[model samples]
Target: MKNFFKIIIIAAFGVMLYPLFDSFSGNGQLNDLASFYAQKENVEKVNSANLVTAVVVTYRGLDTLGEVTILFLTAAIIAFFLTKQSEVRTLRRNSEIFQTAARLLIPVIIMVGVYIFINGHLSPGGGFQGGAVIASAVILMLLAFPNMPFNSKLFGLIESTSGLVFVGIAFLGVLIGTGFLDNAILPLGTFGELLSAGTIPIIYSFVGLKVGAELSNIISGLQSVQADN
Candidate 1:
């Protein structure tokens, strides 16, 4: 069955890639709407060097919020179904190398994830990417220390607080700025710098924290259920 699925996926991928065989023709230029976004006026409004950050956090921030909500719902549903274990279970230990690696690398991995989100307004990454990276660090830790004490409530609190702060910032934009999720609720800091893009970095930071904690909650919930089984 797995082989059949793989074959089907390979064939579908091949069909999708067939279009690439055709000659790529057309002048390299931004489309009308994209060109409008690149205009000095619009760029200055968001004041983010990363165009994707401008679009996601400011222009279509409501959509970003919705996406984050969906993830929260998903984690909630998973936690609801996965009953927590009342007693700790002894699990097999990992190899020495994995244990050492987890100890040494978890902090560095987490720092990298934080960096990705913190500088999201100036670079190619954002909250989601950073959050996923953080989740991966948690995954590695879980694998290394299977019997480690997991703190689901703390993670939940962080997730909830971050989400609330994110919403509060959005409402501030509505009350003070021209529209919902406007980046201008605060001063648009100097461009091409760490503190630029007004509330963008703040929003993205909270988003990363929420997403990371939510994902960790789901993972720990799954682990608990597995222990029960």
Candidate 2:
């Protein structure tokens, strides 16, 4: 009877999802809204080579700010709760090869993360992605050195400073440009160049740092809770 009910539920769920696929034309043409976003006229307005980034950091910039704020609150809450527990937690030993490999990869991973955010306006990746990549490195570090002290003060300062610069630049857009977070506040420079997207690269760099710091803090807090025994 349970098997019979499961089949019925699956059929019903598939039926609901099937209709959603029709919305995608799959003909490789941009929809009207997408066309507007990447339209040639916009190249002058925001010279970012990556249209998605133009939309994310310029058109819908406020949403990104809110997302960062939410992440900050979440990390703060988790850290608060975890601090009550003893910070001394023992981790099982990792193989020498494993430790060596992790140590070698951590710097490479961090560099890739930096590249992703810095090239955000010209390529597919952005601050959030780069930040997550950086956080992954911290995870590896925690596993490699279980007893490594978590630098709450340092990360807090980095996170706070990065967040402030992000907001400050946005407000600068309002004062100098037509709207908030407008990339046009500074010269949009030649399209496709590294320095082409006005303040976008700078903005994304700060965002990447802030996100990386917040995620690292969360991981440090979590590693404190688990014990080897």
lDDT of 1: 0.91
Task: Report lDDT (Cα) of residue 185, candidate 1.
Answer: 83
| Predictions in order: lDDT | 0.91, 0.90
lDDT of 2 by residue, 1-229 (tens): 9999999999999999988886866767878888888788976678899888888888889999999999999999998898736546555788999899998999999999999999999989999999999999999998888767778789999999999999999999889888889778788789899998899999999999999999999999887777546
Residue-wise C-alpha lDDT for candidate 1, range 72-187, written one tens digit per residue: 99999998999876776767778899899899999999999999999999999999999999998998988899878888889999999999999999998889998788889888
Of candidate 2, the 10-residue stretch with the lowest lDDT total is: 83-92
List the candidates' TM-scores in order.
0.87, 0.90
Please give the clash total of every predicted structure, in order: 0, 0
Where does model 1 exceed 4 Å of error? 1-27, 86-88, 227-229
RMSD for each of the candidates = 3.4, 2.1
lDDT of 2 at 184: 80
